[model samples]
Target: MIKTGLYFGSFNPIHVGHMAIANYMVEYTDIDQLWFVVSPQNPLKKKKTLLDDYHRLELVNRAIGDDLRFRASKVEFGLPKPSYTIDTLAYLSEKYPTHQFFILMGSDNLESIHKWKNADVLLANYDIIVYPRPGFNPESAEKYPRVQIANAPLMEISSTFIRDAIKEGKDIRHFLPYRSWDYLQQMNFYKK
Candidate 1:
């Protein structure tokens, strides 16, 4: 079975940090491919500046460009609101039975993953690959044998920082992936 890694994120604007992690996971690890699963907004809770689902997906596509090793997945778009990890995993597993799906997460996220919906079930069913993040450690990962901490390079960049910079009229072209910055600018997103 092809080993694929699913990197779930809102990708408010696909930044260099997100791209670097995906690239590292795909090229340096056993994962044959990585999918940037662009998370959709929970309709009940309206985030002030969160871009539209399709717009965010478009940014992810531009970030990934023509790389065959990476794909922008919208699996959660057709699913129920308040996307749950377990549900998405079940749906993806059923839809693509030929591929073995693994969850990619940051150390911070792993530390608090038990609080997630059906956390136990999700842990028992699929493997999780944790990458390093600033100010967080994956100490809790030891509790799950399927969870492996990877040595992906530390990326200090964050989409929130980029958004704030744009809103403040700061030039953040290089902070985003190729073509993504231009799109964000043209659409005047996050520049209130």
Candidate 2:
């Protein structure tokens, strides 16, 4: 069975930091492939600044262009408005029986994961590959049976910073994949 790692995020523009973590997970870890699971905005709350779901997915697709080991998943798009990890995992497992799926997340996120929906069930069932983030130490997460701390490089860049940079007319093209940057520019995203 293929070991698939699911990296869920808003991927506002799919920046270099996101790619770095994914590449490290696939190349350095036991994961055979990595999927960028683009998260749709919650319908309960109106987020005027967030781009359309399909557009974000398209950005992920472009960012992963020509990479055989990387894929973009829109599974959450058809699910509930505020899709939960447990539900998404259940759907993916039922749909793809041959692939062994695991969750990929940052050390920062791991700290607050206990508050997530069905956190116990998720932590108990799936393997979590945690990438270190600046200021957040995930060494304590090793206590969990399924949590594995990855020696992946610490990434500091954030999508929020990228968006703010774009709005400021900054040259942040190098922060994203070339194809993705082109698409983001063509679509005029993150710019007022």
* lDDT assessment of candidate 2: 0.89
Error of 1 at 32 (Å): 0.4
User: How far in Å is the alpha carbon of 10 misplaced in model 1?
Assistant: 0.2
Off by over 4 Å in 2: 42-46
Superposition error at 3 for model 1 (Å): 0.7
Estimate, for each residue in 27-61, the C-alpha lDDT of model 1 and write its tens digit.
88889999999888643336777899999999999
lDDT of 1 at 138: 64
What TM-score would candidate 1 get against the native?
0.95
The clash tally of candidate 2 reads 0
Q: Taking the tens digit of each residue's C-alpha lDDT, what string does model 2 give over 2-68?
A: 9999999889878999998899999999999999999896433356778888999999999898999
Whole-model lDDT values for every prediction: 0.88, 0.89
